[model samples]
Target: MSFSDAIKICFQKYMDFNGRAKRPEFWWFALFCVVVSLVLGMASSALSTLFSLATLLPSLAVGARRLHDTNRSGWLQLLWIIPLIGWIIMIVFLAQQGSSEDNQYGSTPAN
Candidate 1:
């Protein structure tokens, strides 16, 4: 997916994490998130400390949507609670192919 498409998906789903996401869709959005955070973080760190908090909500929302695209419950994302293992698991899921033709959430990303 294109960067614009990924960002659109991020906001469209917002908090939904029960579908499947293709690789481009996930990574592009992720890149956007990181770039945004870095810029905002630098601004906050140098200017108002409080602005650093900006990344929190956006990050969660994007993460939840990314999980949804994976066909996994957003709740499963909490698996990141386990630290390294959780992180590894989440990465694996993101790396896996989306449902071939939609398992239950909606339609296949390929379609």
Candidate 2:
């Protein structure tokens, strides 16, 4: 998906976590979040914090859907709670190619 499309879908589905999310959808939105956060942070910490807070739900939802695309459960997001290793592991899981065929999570996410 294109960057703007990904961002739109992510925000539209802000709290919807019961589906799949293609790599582009998740990654593009992630890039949006980071870029916006950095820009806002440079302007003002409060703006950055508010922006982060506003996007938190969508971030988690998209992340959950991304994991679902890989045939994993959303609860696995808890892995982020651990230290460096968990972060690395979660990154590996999220960055890896999603399941080619549908499994327990549902059909493969559309690009």
Candidate 3:
């Protein structure tokens, strides 16, 4: 998916955590978040903070969907707090190709 489309979908499903998300969708939105945060941070800390708060749920929801695409549980995101090893594991999982076939999460995310 393109960047704008990914952002749109993520916001639309900000409170949703039940489906799968393709690589492009997840990565593009992640990029958007980082870029926007950087720009906003440079402009004003308050705006950046507000933006982060606004995007937090969408980020989590999209992340959950990304994990679901890999046929893993969203709860696994908790591993992010465990420092280097955990972060590395999550990065590997998120970067790897998602399952092509359906599993417990749902059908494969559409490209």
lDDT of each: 0.66, 0.94, 0.93
How would you encode candidate 3's per-residue C-alpha lDDT over 44-101 as one tens digit per residue? 9999999999999999999999999998999999989999999999999899799999
Alpha carbon lDDT at 29, candidate 1: 74
Compute each candidate's TM-score over C-alphas: 0.71, 0.97, 0.96
Across 29-76, the per-residue lDDT of candidate 1 in tens digits comes to 778776776776666755333433543454466565456666777677
- Candidate 1: TM-score? 0.71
Candidate 3 structure lDDT: 0.93
The collision pairs in model 3 are none
For model 2, how does the per-residue alpha-carbon lDDT over 1-111 read when each residue is reduced to its tens digit? Answer: 899999999999998989799899999999999999999999999999999999999999999999998889999999999999999999998998999998787888776
| Superposition error at 103 for model 2 (Å) | 1.6
- Model 1: clashing residue pairs? 17-68, 18-68, 19-68, 19-71, 20-69, 21-69
* Alpha carbon deviation, residue 42, candidate 1 (Å): 1.8
lDDT of 2 at 57: 99
Ranking by lDDT: 2, 3, 1
Stretches of candidate 1 exceeding 4 Å from the true structure: 15-19, 46-65
Better of 1 and 2 by TM-score: 2
